[model samples]
Target: MPTPDFIRDLRRHVGTAELWIPAVRAVVVRRRADGRVLPSPEVLLVRRSDDGAWTVTAGILEPGEDPADGAIREVQEETALTACPVRVAGVFAHGPVEYTNGDRCRYLDTVFEMETLDGEPRVNDDESIDVGWFPVTALPESLAEDQRMVIGWALDAGAPAQFTEPGTSHTEAAGEPAAQHD
Candidate 1:
């Protein structure tokens, strides 16, 4: 995944205090022909060029861009995978990721469950050092902690759309009953 020039310039000047930004991530999964999701289905993940930690296809939404469209575009831009979001899987306020230069930023992100329409993943841009599909149970050891929970839930066919409240333990919010997706 290539880092846009504007982002590179912004990073150079960003300082220690946390900056909040809206972002989106695509949890793209494969399904069996019968429409049942595969157990331990493969998911698309990308290794960050700077940190090497794996994260799902994601990016900051361009000014006023819709989150679903951003999710689709980011998946394509980052992984060479074309996808369409099925539904909202979850939403979160994550980070305070402190860069080496001490600049920190937090993401208010929406995670969407998407179905791949075409294309195999390859590193499509420089922002990512590598890209591949991995079974949910065998994800890369360097997977980003912020993304792991949602990835797990999305892979589990029985899991429902999760709604998390910021600043609380994820466990405390894990299993409230809710409407199911089709």
Candidate 2:
């Protein structure tokens, strides 16, 4: 999707200045017909149109929107899937992202562990070029480190929501650093 109208309006005033944006990520996992989370579950991922990288469903929250609602909305909009937010998996301050257009922003991200309720995965919007599910043990190499970290938190459902302290990397916050599997 194009930049939201509210952000565009803000951009007109702030130009490319760094903005603190609230965003949400949905780590959607599919369960078995018996309602148990699969012993080896699959996660919904989108291949981003902007960079062709595989990542969890994520987007900026609309002003005044509840973070969980925004996560559900983004999943439906981006992947044509309906998901229920099971829990808040993690929160992080991510990026001083510089877009190709030169817009800069840092995201305060709320990550949710979601259960897929219905619908097939597909590229439902322009933001993504493809959408599909991959087993947690065999995710695509293109997925980013931060995305992988959030996925790990979601899978470790019993663990408390992970948070990062200022100047600490996600690995340090979560403990020992490792690869995507964490």
Highest-TM-score candidate: 2
Q: Output the lDDT of residue 176, model 2.
A: 35
Best by lDDT: 2
Which residue pairs show collisions in model 1?
Answer: 1-125, 1-126, 1-127, 1-128, 2-125, 2-126, 2-127
**Candidate 2 runs further than 4 Å off:** 33-39, 169-182
lDDT of 2 by residue, 17-47 (tens): 9998998989998756465767788999988
The TM-scores, one per candidate, come to: 0.77, 0.88
**Each candidate's clash count:** 7, 0
C-alpha positional error of residue 78 in candidate 1 after TM-score superposition, expressed in Å: 0.8
Worst 10 residues of 1 by lDDT: 173-182
Candidate 1: misplaced stretches above 4 Å?
1-17, 33-39, 156-160, 165-182
RMSD score of candidate 1 (Å): 6.6
What overall lDDT goes with each candidate model? 0.71, 0.82
